[model samples]
Target: MSIPSKEFTGRHMLMTTVAFFTVVIGVNVTMALYASSSWSGLVVENTYVASQEFNRKAAEAKTMAASGVVGKLSFLHGAIHYDIRNRDGSPAAVDEVAANFKRPVGDHEDFHVAFAKVSEGRFEATHRLTSGDWIVEIVSRRDGKVVMHEADRIDTGGSGQ
Candidate 1:
């Protein structure tokens, strides 16, 4: 009875290396494609203009803070409630209040809703939002100028409030 010997060759090593690298390269390509297709990576249309605008907004926010104008915001029962007040806790009145809701991951679900003053310095809007992580931006405008601005992140998971 003759026993056949299985020999290890350079060809066999080369094939094994190629197979391993092929899978690694394939996975990397797949991940790259998915990341590129997920988002545009452009938060603003123009970077220079956005930077200038951001600086201006920062100045405005600083001026507002110095003037003792501030605000508090909350979300509940399919409504956005906000209270604008001064450093002394006196209610501050504004011409109009605008709220912008944006999902953290994508801009597809971004929406703007205007809040009406329910009471003195207290604004509320009935805009129903889905359960997820949301970036809430509230701006109180007076005479076509931003008087008070605030931004926050909220996760509606358990409180149900």
Candidate 2:
């Protein structure tokens, strides 16, 4: 005897569609929540104010570049080191040095380190960093004015520029 074949119905199509959409929507919602929780979604508090300050900040950077005032940063073991110099290759004297070490994708591992002057134009601080991508920002200020501001990307396990 030949076996009877079952026919596909609208109910089957409906269930298939529902299952596909459910999976799609479920994944999307999961991704959205994860992203929102990990990042604050704001690079600055006020975009308008930051835009207005852009010109001034650029000018300051140019002035520092012209004077050859620059900062060099390095990371090894658990310590961060910096060296600031002027056009004449002399150590640039700054009142303070501070740095922010940020993970590229999350805030949970971000930290700030205050540098102590080790010698003329050199400073060092110990940080707790792991092996990964890091965004490093170093600011040198003299008399409450920024003398040098530099940013770089460094790999914790390798030498960073």
Candidate 3:
């Protein structure tokens, strides 16, 4: 028996379309991941807080939110005073930071953040944070790219500082 010419044409067309869609979807996904990784994206990081392990934090936050464990951060210049309020008039919050900075770095705990503390207009991360090259992405409720600062890495290992 011989295969019908129409059957061959229809199968070929369907396969071609499916292949096209697959490639398109793959590229879209890759681009999305890169953009999302950036500081500014769909889910903005207004105060330099990157939700690296969002799912994990979400689960934890959900549980803690009920317990009234609101996240807060503090920016410090000398690891003593709140530098966040020094320059900017706005008060900032430290959401979370690396608990164990001395330990090996992981995909998530890249750095820490303190969120939504409004002493003035500026915001801070966390006190005792694992100091070292932090990306201070400061956005504003008014607009984007308000200002950003990068702080030198410090030791939280309690090395007699």
Find the candidate with the highest TM-score and give its number: 1
Predicted candidate 3 versus true structure: per-residue lDDT over 1-161, tens digit per residue: 99756556888999999999999999999998896676321334353565666676577545543533222224355342223332233433332222212223333544333344334443333344444433333222223322223223243443321
Q: What is the lDDT for 137 in model 2? A: 82
Per-candidate RMSD, Å: 6.1, 6.6, 14.2
How far off is residue 160 in model 2, in Å? Answer: 12
> Across residues 1-161, which tens digit of lDDT does each residue of candidate 2 receive?
99999989999999999999999999999999998778643366689999999999898778878888878887666687899988888999897999998876668988898999999899989866777777888889899988888878777664432
Which of 2 and 3 is the better model by TM-score?
Answer: 2
Higher-TM-score candidate of 1 and 3: 1
At residue 151, give the lDDT of candidate 1.
79
Clashes in predicted model 2: 0
TM-score of each: 0.68, 0.66, 0.27
TM-score of 1: 0.68
Off by over 4 Å in 2: 1-42, 158-161
Candidate 1: stretches off by over 4 Å: 1-42, 158-161
Off by over 4 Å in 3: 1-8, 41-80, 83-161
